[model samples]
Target: MKVKLASSYGFCFGVKRAIKIAEGYEDSATMGPLIHNQNEIDRLKTDYNVGLYNNLTDVKPKDTIIIRTHGIPKNDLKDLRKKDAKVINATCPFVTTPQQIVKKMSQENYSILIFGDEAHPEVKGVKSYGEDQEDVHVILSISELDNINFKYDKIATVAQTTKKKETYLEIVNALILKNKEVRVFNTICDATFENQDAARELSKEVDVMVVIGGKNSSNTKQLHSICLENCQDSYLIENAKELDPNWFKNKNLCGITAGASTPDWIIQQVVDEIEKY
Candidate 1:
């Protein structure tokens, strides 16, 4: 019945900073999903009544628009400002690096490829940075790289900040197969890499793995995937209440890991609940 938790299981610095900014911005609306964690988002809504708008076109002139940590494109900023909406830039500094690199790569006429979940908010923003020009494509996985038909003479790649290093490297190696001149920014955030590494290590030694985070959380899903790879006894849940005690039947050395967006309190609650059983 013993339980072990990964040291890197809680909110990463980037997610903490983004949430702090959101907490401070009272009476404002985020331009998109503030964080992947629904529990935190639900809390924010209950306390601050903060709103979310994917399209700023209908935003009230007096409302302030906060950009989520994942960030938005340059054109979106211009348009928001033109609409007389106050723009709060909550973009994680790590995410900004890839955006800057994409801009630089586009100017150099090198074929640009972004490696990450194409449907993710981070990847969507990265894509926007290159959408103005026609030289960019996004590859979410190593398998997607085969579809890219760009010339090998000039190529550049960047990863979403929350991607696992293994997946990122897999896609990078795929690109290398087709192009020798490929440039990579290694844009994956340090926090994400540490969290995944810790989870992977824990999964190897644990009898069962519990990944705690919102279902919408991309990084949490990745962590769960990593756990499943290392140990089949892996489950993803948003809260301790969602966990069924029967799943741990006759199991020991339970491993618990949370996503970057998960708050410490939720993690502790889950761990405490597991201990109670």
Candidate 2:
């Protein structure tokens, strides 16, 4: 049996930055959860007085606010400052671009639509980027757009940084058919695009694929979807301990891929466990 790993897999720059900041400030008592990864959150709990609050209303003044890579609401930040929390920004630069674009669209008086999963923290941050007058809509699929009847007027669309390549284009093409003035920005990060493309390619060559990342990880879940499109034997496991040997009983070749938030050491352990089988 042979094991192949995806070339474009592993942690991206943004995840690294967010995690690095969290680790650096772990000794501080004021930091919050750096990102949504449960493993990382557990590690952070040992160092900082981190609380997972949906809103900032629970944030105290002395707390050093450790912002996640997805960024936060402008009002929330302003409110945090007012409450005297020392803000430690950890937002990813790739995500910052869409926020800047939204500001421009707001000034141009265009109705905005964000293509992404509505429940995602990144999508929520993008939605909060809109100003008072600009109306931003979130679309998970093309079917949802039928409810909003708007003409070929000034309309702008931006994608969440980690959105799937195929789905983003499908929506863009669909919108182009309905409105003449529809503008789209494929804000999906370069790393995300490369990772997904590589994972999809690997799925075709391997009999089984083992994806390593937390379940809540957006990019990791997308990688699983890409593998499922090509190979049904794909398994998503957070770590080596979760991998069941039965899944690969008759497999000759296995492909291993990790999410942007996955650590290399953990990935190696997963690979080692499979090798022992």
Candidate 3:
């Protein structure tokens, strides 16, 4: 079988930066999983003795806290400050752009509409930027736009940094049709768009596609979704151990792609293992 990898895959600038920051500090703990990939987190834990805390309550004032790339809510930052914990803000700059825009637009009385999953940490952080969290709306699909009942003359929309550009644009178009005045910012990261496009292209050329990344990673999931849409035999796996040799038994070509948070070493390992088959 011929194996091909997406042109754009693995750690993006933001994730690399976050990892570098985390590596620089000793006796530090991340506010959450620094990035979604468990393998890298495990490596960091074993090599640097980094700790992961789900909430501030578990962190001590003396311990250095590294914020995850998917930033925390505004109130959570305040709470961290109150606790006097040493903080290393590793929030991706791309994610911060939407947060600033949402806060500014909300302060100006524009209704905020975030085009992303409500449960996602990045989306939750963006939602917290609104003047009133109750007024802010998070819509994952065009259909969800219908559920918004706020009577605002002006609406401002932003998307999660890892969201698909096409999906974001589709939601923005729908918002324009439903609202009188709509201000939209394409908050989706450039790398995400490129990665998705590359994955789609790679999937089309291969008989079976393997998407590597953390299952919980939004960007990785998006990649898998795009791959599946283009290729029927696409599979999503966190590591090479999850790979089933049977999937490649009759396949002539295999495509590989990974999420932004995935490390190069892991991707390489997957590639090596697949080649063995």
Candidate 4:
């Protein structure tokens, strides 16, 4: 099989910045998995002595704490600062933009609506910035809009950094139709747009598609979804070991794309493994 790589794939600006920041702070711990990629996190742990802390209670006073790229809840950050830990924020500027927007809008008394999965770390962090927690609502789809009862006449909305733009637009459209005053801030990362578009185009031309990234990665799953729409033989895998030789049987062309959190090393490993098949 001839192996093809997507025109745009691998680490985005935010992921790259986070990795660089973490590398400099060896022996420190990240509040959460710095980025979604486990392979890179493992590499950092082994090579740099960086540790992972899943909760605020795990953090110690004066400990070096590097914030995850996804950021933490507003109150969590405040608590961490109160502990006197050396807090280094690695949040992607793209994600921070929406958080700030939500903070400002909520303080101004505008109901905040976030278009994202409530369970996602990014969405959770953004939702916490609202002055009135009850006014802040998170929704995964247009259907959830029905459950929201905004107290304020004016509303402001933002999307998860890695969400599909088309889906966000649908929610925005619904809000505009029902609400008299709506403030929409485009929060989707530009790199996400490039990566998803590239994956969609490559999947259309290949016999099989391989998306490389972490299992917990929202953007990687989105890429897999896009690929599946174009090629049913699309597989989402974290590493080369997960690749099945049977998936590539008789396939003439294999296209590979990765989430923004993926590294070049992982992508190369997948490509090398595919070539062997």
Give each model's whole-structure lDDT.
Answer: 0.84, 0.80, 0.90, 0.94
For model 3, what is the alpha-carbon lDDT of residue 74?
A: 93
Tell me which of candidates 2 and 3 scores higher on TM-score: 3
In model 3, state the lDDT of residue 277. Answer: 87
TM-score for every candidate vs. truth?
0.92, 0.91, 0.97, 0.99
Clashing pairs in 4: none
Q: Candidate 2 residues 1-277, lDDT tens each?
A: 4689998898899988887776776444322345546666666666554545556777776777777888776667778899897788888989888887877886687778888888877777778877743377888888898876543267788999988768888988888887768878879899988888899999999999999898988889989998999999999988889988898898899999988888787888888889887
Off by over 4 Å in 2: 29-33, 47-54, 132-134, 150-152
State candidate 4's TM-score. 0.99
Q: What is candidate 4's lDDT per residue for 1-277, written digit by digit as tens?
A: 7999999998999999999999999899999899999899999999999999999999899899999999899999999999989999999998899999999999999999999989999999999999999889999999999989998989999999999889899999999999989999999999999999999999999999999999899999999999999999999999999999999998999999999999999999889989988
- Across 151-226, the per-residue lDDT of candidate 1 in tens digits comes to 4367888988877677778877777776768898888888888899999999999999999997888888989999
lDDT value for model 4: 0.94
Residue 7 in candidate 4, Cα distance off native in Å:
0.2
Name the better of 2 and 4 by TM-score: 4
Task: Check candidate 2 and list the clashing pairs.
Answer: 30-64
Residue 272, model 2, lDDT: 86
Model 3: worst 10 consecutive residues (lDDT sum): 144-153
Ranking by lDDT: 4, 3, 1, 2
Report the candidate with higher lDDT, 1 versus 3. Answer: 3
lDDT, model 2 = 0.80
